[model samples]
Structure formats: C-alpha cells, structure tokens
Target: MQMPLLIAADWLLVVCAEQLAYWLRRDGLPIAVPTFHIPDVYLYLIVPAIFLVFLHESRMKFRAFPLWKMTQAVFHAVLWSVLAIIMLMYFGHVAQVVSRLFVAMTGVFAFLFLIAGRTALAALLDRYHLFEVPVLLVGGGDEADALLSTLAAHGGCGMHCIGLVTDARVPQKAAARCAVLGHLADLERVIGETGIQNVLVTASGADSDEQVRLVRRIQPLVENVVLVPDLAGLPVANSEIEGILEGRHIFLRFRNNLARRKNLVFKRLFDIVLCLLGAPLVLPVCLAIALAIKHDDGGPVFFAHRRVGQGGKEFPCYKFRTMVTDGDRILADYLAAHPEARKDWENDFKLKDDPRVTKIGAFLRKTSLDELPQVWNVLKGDMSLVGPRPIIRAEIPKYGEHFADFCLVPPGITGMWQVNGRSDTTYEGRVRMDSWYVRNWSVWIDLACLVRTFAVVLRREGAY
Candidate 1:
C-alpha cells in the first residue's frame, strides 16, 4: 500500500534524466563543456509539473504498477516526453531562454530514465512482494482452478490470492495454493482477517441471481472486484467492461474477432513497404536459389502449395523448392526404412534427417531463406508477414476449436511458432502458441515476432 513512493520516484527520475541530459548535451555525448546552456528553471520546475499532468492524463492512479504493465508505463513516458517538448516550444518562446537542442536531449533522456526507473522499481516491488494485494477468490470448480493458476503465474500483477471463498461442494482441500479462509456467508470475516483489497468472482457453479447477489454484497467491501465470465474456454480477442440494469450488474464481454478493415489496411501497408524495401537485396539471392534448385534436381525452381489462409480460403503459399522431385514417394520409402524418422514426422510434421531434402534446400531451410518467396504472398494479400503458420486442409482439425480463431486472420510464412520453435515444436503445442498469438494480436507483437525470427534463424535453434 506504500505506492506513493513509486509516484515520488517517477517524478524524481524524470528530473534526474533532464539534468543528466543537460550535462550530456551541453558537453556532447562525451560530457566535455557546455556549448549550449539549457534554461535551468525549465529543467528543475516547469517540466516536472508537465510530466505529472501527462501521467495523470494517461489515467495513472496511485496504485501498484504490477497490473499496469511496464510496457504501458514506458509508452506513457514516451507520450509525456513528446508532449513536454511541445509545451516547451510554446512556453520557451515566451521565456526567451530555452535551448531547442537541450529540450530535445532532455526529452530523450527523460524517456529512457523514466522507463529504466519504473522497471527497476517494478522489479524491486516484485522481489519484495510489495505490490501484492491480498484478494479473495469467489466460486469453485474448473473456473476457480483456472483463476488460481492464473493468479499464481501472474503474482507480479499485484494479485496475491490470500484466501478462497468457494462453494461447499467443491472440496477446499483441492486448492493447495491458498487456504479456504471461509465460506460465502463469512465473506466479510475473511476480508477483515485477510486485509483483502481485491475480490475475484469466478462463479462457475452459481446462477445469474447468485452472482448478482455476491457482487452486490462484495461491492463496498473491496476496492476492486472482477468477474470471470464463462467464455474463458474459448479464444476471444478484444474484451470490454460494461454495466447492465442501471449499473448494478457489471461484466466483461470477451469479444470474438472483430476484423476491422483499417487494421488490415495497416497490415497491408506494412507488408508492402517492407517487401519493396527488401526486394533489391532478396531478388538476387532468390535468383541464385532458383538456379541451384533447378541444377540440383532439374525440377521447378519454386514450390507453390495450397495452404489455408484467412477465412478458410485456400491460397498458393510459395517457397523455393526444398525437397527432391517425387518427394512424396521418396518420403514414403524413407519412412518405411526408418521407424524413428516416421515417428518424428508424425509427431511434428517434420523430419530432422529427411532424405527428400536437397543439400541446398537444407541450407536454405536452416537459415529461413526458404520463406523469402513468401513476401510475394504477403504483397498479393494472401498471407501476413507474421501470423499463424500457413496450414493446409489436412492440418485444420489439428487446431480443433482454434481453427475458427486461426482462420480469423491470414496465415503467415513466419509466426509465433516459427520464431519460438519451428520444426522442433509439436503440432499441438503450435496450436496453443498460434491461438495465443491470434487472441493477443497487436502490431507490436507482430513486429516483435518478425524481429525475433531473424535471431531464431541465425541461432538455428529449432530449424532442421
């Protein structure tokens, strides 16, 4: 509950960054001498107020930031720094003594230091469990178990589930992580004893009326109360908080994939720009690869296979020919000879020592040069630059319920699975990975995966 210290730290860190920036910029990066003097008053006074206001605008409450997330805090820091620069531009002109270079330098340092400070503080809090908010879990059965698991995994999210208030039918001994402090009737007593600030309602067995009653009773007792809806089993994308019946009953709507054209338009523009930029570098290499493939097997240079794309429509996902001619026949013969290879192929749809792969193909696959041609697929609107791996019709059932979610977006040549572990990942494991990626889709995540793909390829950790 001693969270005001974090707020104070936030302010002080920005001021420190500004001072550091002043010295660095005045003396260059080497810190020699002040060529341009920064207005001391702005660095010490006006800028701190500006930062607090921007942070307030970002809806930063005096709460533990474990739930707020470091990425969001860093993002807020950037936003405040930009706004601070704009404010200085206006106010500095009136003050008659502010250096533009100094202001720019201050902004840059403020951004970095704010992030670094918050990260260090968050880590300290996590280490000491300072941000841990004692909470009571309401309900029982599978939902309760899932919530318990989630809370345990995300302890740094400020949720320390101190006690449980489950139904009598659900054995209290079953929940080994936290003690069953009391039953539903003794909820207030449990809260008082546990010093609970948050209450999580996961009423799996309870009906709507019981849920409403529980929520009404627990509303004033805790600072925050969360309801876990029945939709947890399904992969939902965007969710929203809403109130019904004149604000008495509130619940979260776990939204299904709402494919917005604007987002797709953004993705398309990103794909096109990246492709055009890399075309020159990749084209020559692609030509050489084609020639080698042709020379190796006297077969087609490119291999285009019909793979499932967005909306369950099939598209020709292109790649350089990596397998020998009559690949299927060769694979059957190979599998017949080696039981271990057959088992490996059955498990992950990949073979570490595939007899069908040409030497050139093996090298290309290892380095992920095989996917260079799929940039064409990205440009032609068939696949994304980063998404779920392109699945053929035979692989649809492998996704199960995940199939619908997977098809909601275009398949990718490189994705969460490809980056995390390509051929080494099991088919079921990939389904889970791709499902999570789709459910938590963001432009930042896509960019991160694309960047990590290079590292993964270079390391050749999972690639065959």
Candidate 2:
C-alpha cells in the first residue's frame, strides 16, 4: 500500500522541483541552470520518507480509503510538503534565493499531482483488496441479512465478512454462505479463535445491554467496533465524531450547525435585498394571484396555518390559500368516502385532483405559487431563505426524537429535499434529506440549492 503512494510522491516531487527550477530560470532568478544540478534532489529522497512516516504514524491503511479520508490525507501531505520545502530553503541559506512564484507553483503542482496519482493508487488498492479488513457480523436476523446484502452490493467498503455469530433461530435459515460461528454469548471465544479485527453488531435482535457488553468485551481484541442503531423508518442524516474522551470513550453527535448566525445573517441580508429590489415586480404577481383566487372563489386570498419552526416553536405560516373555505373538513369527508385517497394522503400529504382546490388554487398549487406568501416568514425571521421545509404542528410527534435536530435551524422557503423531489419523495426520505442538509450546511450549498430550486420550480416536476 505504501509502495505505490511513496513512488507517486517521489515522481510528484521530481516533477515539481524541475518545474520550479525552470520557472526560476524564466523569472531571471540567479539559480543554477538545469544541467546536472537538480536544485532540490534532497527533496525527492526525504519527502517520500517523511510521508511514509506520517502515513504509518496516522495508520492510514488503504482499507480505509474512503474519498473523504483520502482527501484529508492529501491535504495533510501538501501542507507538510510546503512547510518542508520552506524549511529546506531556509536552512540552505537560500531564503531570498528561490523565487516565491516557484515555491507557490510547486505547492499547487504537488497538490494536483498527488490528487491525480492517488486516484490511480486507489484503483490499484481496490483491485488487489490489499487492505481489506476482516469484519465479523454479530447478529443473524433480518437486519444482518440486509446489511450483508448491502455490503455485497457495495464492494468498495473493503469489509470482508468472515462469518456471523448469533443465537437467533430465524437467522440460521437466512444466513447465506456466511457460517454461524457461535452463539451471541460465545462472541469473545469466536473473536479469539478467528482474530476478527472489526465487529458489527446488528441492532435488531441484540438487546441494548447485550450490544454494550459485546462492545466492551470486544474492544480489547478488535481495533474497530460499530453498533448499527435499530432506527427503522428514522432518517440517518450523516454520522460524525464529536470527540474522544479520556482517550477511551468516543462521542458522536449529529446536527446541522452550518446554518449558524453568520449564515443566518447572510441569508437574511440576501432575502431583504432581493425582496426589496423585486417587491415592485412581485407585488403585481401577488395581486394577480389574489384576483385569480377571488374570481375562482369569493374567499380570503391568504391562508395561515400553525407550522412548527426552529426549536419546535409553533408559528403561523403564511401561504396563498389554495383550497376552499372548509378544505380540511372536505378532505376528511372525501377520504372517508374514498379509502384509496387515504393512501395517497398518507404518502405525500397531497391529493391528486383534490376537490377542495378552487379552479385557480389547482393552478397555483401546480406552479407552487401558493408558497409566495412565505416571503413574509423570511422577513419576520421566523424562517430562512434556504432550510428544511416547515411541517405542521400536528406532524411534530410523528418525527419522533430526531425532530429536534431538524428544527435547530429555521425552516426555509426552498431547501435541498424540496428542490430534489417535494411531494414525490417518501416521508422518510424527506426527513433524511432535511437531516443531511442540517448536518452538511454551507453557504455555497445553500446557494446551489437556491439556484436548483428556481430550475425545479420552473420545470414543476414534483410541485403538486
């Protein structure tokens, strides 16, 4: 594993050194011409050696070559290489000797070179399974079978399942070629015999106490131990390590903290600027929508509903009324009459060809113009320009405990899940997307989502 990375690093160093020398000559720096004198020959030798040391010290085995981890390593390598080059130049009493442009160019060249070469290296690592880790599955239930199938499908995780260990009766029937090593109680003995380096506890059949015991017992024997949470129908946004305590216990927390005060400030400023600038243009459309609504049905043009917002606060969310006066009552009556509509309602909270929607309301809902009134929500600080969609107060309990994480950030007019597939996506998928957005929030991501929202709204792919 280190051989390819070392060779790649050496080649990258040589190329960068040569380029730096050439660029220095071009810049009229009084550096020796390219002949037999390589300005940084020592770099070619020492850089790769130091890289190997760091790689070994960090334990960056090829088995854990996820793109994210690889990127982090590359970044670390580039940073160290830059610092090393600077130190070498300073020690050689050549601080003012080398062109700054040459040093900067070398850093950029090394970064790109390593990134490209790492891709090839990763391919080679995957081909040989050189760093595959032996993983032991500790359950024999349906979740274990599903996890096995998933692992089989994703061959790149580099986890080679040795076998399964479970006392559950049903697991034996579904256990594919994976042999049942022993009962759950005999996990320690199995680990001792097989030398399993990783243990994955399926959260389904195993009780919490059993899972905790398995972790405690196996921690001494194995290098990695992970517990799969039994969160069926719950969204697993994205996992992240919070910290390590006392060099023993690891803590993991999940929440989207990207929509912080800085982001909130920027988003609000953007909204206020855009809203003020376009108010004249938007006013006419608002009036046109009001006229259309009034013409279709002589009822109020604006609709207000209690929606759960940041920190689980209920606020009156505004939207263009896209239904008749007694739309909710009518919906209940309709669902009672036609049981099939209940399925659609349950899935998407929407009804196709909803009878309660007035003639203009149907058009507004299709184009999503009914949500225009939420601009006021953005103005009032009750919502953001980009965030998770707000849900009704009545829908809060259904989200369970993870709902608090989702509500940490204010709801948005348009968000990742909304632009991706609003009503068309599964409820669980929406929650997951929302959770992911919260976990991985960034201004650029918010801007991208906003741009995509415009395109999606124009296309109206899943508006209704």
Candidate 3:
C-alpha cells in the first residue's frame, strides 16, 4: 500500500511539475515573441517514466531515511531523468522546437515537487499510521531504548514497535515504553501469537558466532530480520562494507572525507559562495542589530573571541556583543550567590537566566542574530557555513581524543549541534556531534543542516 501510494503521488507530482514548467517557460517568463512548440505526448510520458524507473532503482520505499539521504536520492533521480530528456530531444531532432529553458525548468520544478510531495506523504502516513510496519524488539538494553527513541523522534520512519522479547534484565524505563512479550526461548510462540512481520534484534552482548546462529534460526520465522550493529558514535555516511572469500570474510571501511584535497577545496568554495550571496541580507540585519545594541548600551557592537580553527590554528571568531563589559565579574558574583547555577554553567557553559545580558542582546541571542558577524570569518577562510562548532581553548581538553577530528574542518556558525539543540545539548554531546560532522561531512549534510537551522532559530529552541 505504501509503495503504490508513493508511486501514484510521485507520478502526479512529476506531471504537475512538467505542466508548471511549460507555463513558466512559454507564458510566465517568455524568452522571445516566437510561437511556443508544445511538448509532445510521448516526450511527457517518457520523462515521467524515466523518473519512476530511477526512483525505483534507488529503493524509494517505506523506510527510515534522514533528510540528507532522501534529498540525495531524489536529486539524483530528477537529474538523470532530465539528462535523458535532453538526449531524447537531440536524437529525435526536436531540440530546436523543444526549448532548452523548458527542459531546465522542468528538472528544477520536478526536484522540488518530488521532495515536497514525499515529505507531505510521510507526514500524512505517520499521522494516521497508514503504512507503519509493526515489529518486535528483541532486546531490552540501552541500545534497544535508543532505537525506540529514534523511532519516536522520526515519526515518518514507518517503523512501529509492538513489544519486546528479551532474556536479559529489562530496565524499568524500557518496560514502561513497551511490554515484554516473552523471553528468547518463547520468541517463536510470541511471533506466532502476535503475527508480527518483522523482528529487530540488538545483539550487543552476543558473540559473533551466536549472533550469526540466532539470525539464521530466526530467518525462517520472520519476513524481515534487522540486526542492529554495536557501532555507536562512529561515522556511517562514507563507510562501506567489503566481502571477500565468497562472502565469508567481511570488513567495514570508513573514509576520512577531509583528508582528500578536493573535498577541502569544495567545502571552502561552498562557504565563500554562500557567504557572498548572503551578504546583502546579512549586512542590513547586522546594521540594525548594531544600532539596537548601541541604543541599549554604549558598548562595542562586534565581539571577537579566540577559537580553535582548522589545523589547530587560533583565529578570532566574530559575533554581535550580547553581554555587558563586566560579564565575567557579574557571572562570578551571580554564581557565588546562586550555587545551583554554577553546575549548569559548568556542564553546558550556558545559563537560561543570566544577569549579564542586555534586553536587546537577549533577543539577539534568542534569534541567533548574534552569529551574523561570523560571515566575515567564513569569507576569510577561518570558518565554514556548516561544520563543527567553534570551541575555545579552555574547552579543548574536554574533547579529549575527539579533538583531533574536530580540528579537521573549520568551525561553522551553525552545525549539527546548533540544529539538534543549541544551548539545550550538553557539552559532551556537542563534542560527539562535532566529531561526527567532521567524519561524515558532505554537501548534502551541509545543505540539510542549513535548512533545519531556519526552523530551529524561528522556534527559539534551546536558546539562551
């Protein structure tokens, strides 16, 4: 049902985009006063068919996919379809009649339409549980709880946990979320009774041989058996598995993306282009904020703090001043008076309520307008638009071994931590996120982070 519905939605959206593109090229933004040559029926049919074929090959289905993964898949499908259309036009000698602008417009419209359509479809399905795959969890440990939380966080993933089957001691919190159906020995009976189609196993404590045997034994009883690997806090984006000796020996390989010179250059170019294009908007807002800060208090508008950049280089990271001149003194006095506040500051380096922030500064911080000045750092090659968060020297020791990975890429104004939960995330969590971003950095991930940053800022989530 999910697959069929998705196919229908995708076809409809592609057709609509073609018509919209035709209108835009012929009527909305006409290139010349020449008569328009309407696209042939076969051309329209073939283009959509190509898209469907490519999307099918990409495994567009009811499953869990992060935003970047979905975007990458959809973008490739539309791109290939557009290229095929161009080749057909040239080979059929219709390139003169079929406007190149029309073809270009169609590809742009199709990409947007397909992404929007799929996102809406997922939301609708999640809201009604229309195509959720009910599965039984086979563990009751921390890994199992984390998987459950992930399912809850990504409602559109289409996975639903009915119950659990475990032999180990189940945590009280895990039991509260989902009941234990039966022990490992009665797993077959529980599945038969419940008629579950999928089983998700977390073989965290099991040896390799036992895990393999357990999976082989369960293969005959379930439609799908998903084995969760115990590789938390590792880079998965650029990792691949290799099989040798007739699939007897398998090895996982992880690539350090930043180690390649081309990737580093691409990232720099991405940052510069985005910063330049965004300057017109950013400059005006910065000016307004500067005036507001000056009106609130006669202090310097811009603040530059020392932060570690790429290659362990020290640079001045700029931001709009959001605190009083005597911020340190005020913090010391306040922490002395309020002993509980000291713990929060030590843990996260942030305070929900602080005495040093001015009225205008608080609003700037909440909206993240204070970080607008960092665009200069981006243009200067000291920072990126999306990478790890900049850390001060005092916080270097906290990252420990992960600090090497953190310095691989320049710091960013917004990154994984900012989008996840700016001030709400713990310092250790921030370090882990930074490490992950450094390892799994890609153009798609950066674009997705930029998109989510808007929603996070607008919602004022985890802001101080």
RMSD of each: 5.9, 9.9, 2.2
Ranking by lDDT: 3, 1, 2
TM-score of model 1 vs. true structure? 0.70
All candidates' TM-scores? 0.70, 0.51, 0.93
Task: Give the per-residue lDDT digits (tens) of candidate 1, residues 1-464.
Answer: 44567668878987887777667666657644554554567666667767766665655533344322444555566676666666766765733445656666666777667656765676576567785667778877777876676555544355577768866555544478767777888888887777787888988868899988999899898899888767754534445778998986767676433266777778778888988998999899999988888888798988999999999999999999898879999999999999988887766677888888889999998898988899899889998888888887887877899998788788887888987668777788799888887876666567667666777888987887
Report clash pairs, candidate 1.
Answer: none
| CA-lDDT, candidates in order | 0.75, 0.71, 0.85
Q: lDDT per residue, candidate 2, 1-464, as tens digits?
A: 45565566546654664466455656546654333233454545554455444444565654445443455665677667667766776677544345455556566666556655655565565567656667898876788877776565445456778888887754543476477888978888999999888898886866768777777877888899888777654323334665566756665555444546776667668777876787788788999998988887789989988888998898899999988898879999999999999988876677876889887887888888898888888889888878888998656766776596677888988897888788778887788777767766655556557656776788887876
* Local lDDT at 16 for model 2: 64
TM-score ranking of the models: 3, 1, 2
Tens digits of per-residue lDDT, candidate 3, 355-426, equal: 999898899889999999999999998999998989888778899999999878899999999999888888
Whole-model lDDT for model 3 versus the true structure?
Answer: 0.85
In terms of TM-score, which candidate is stronger, 1 or 3? 3
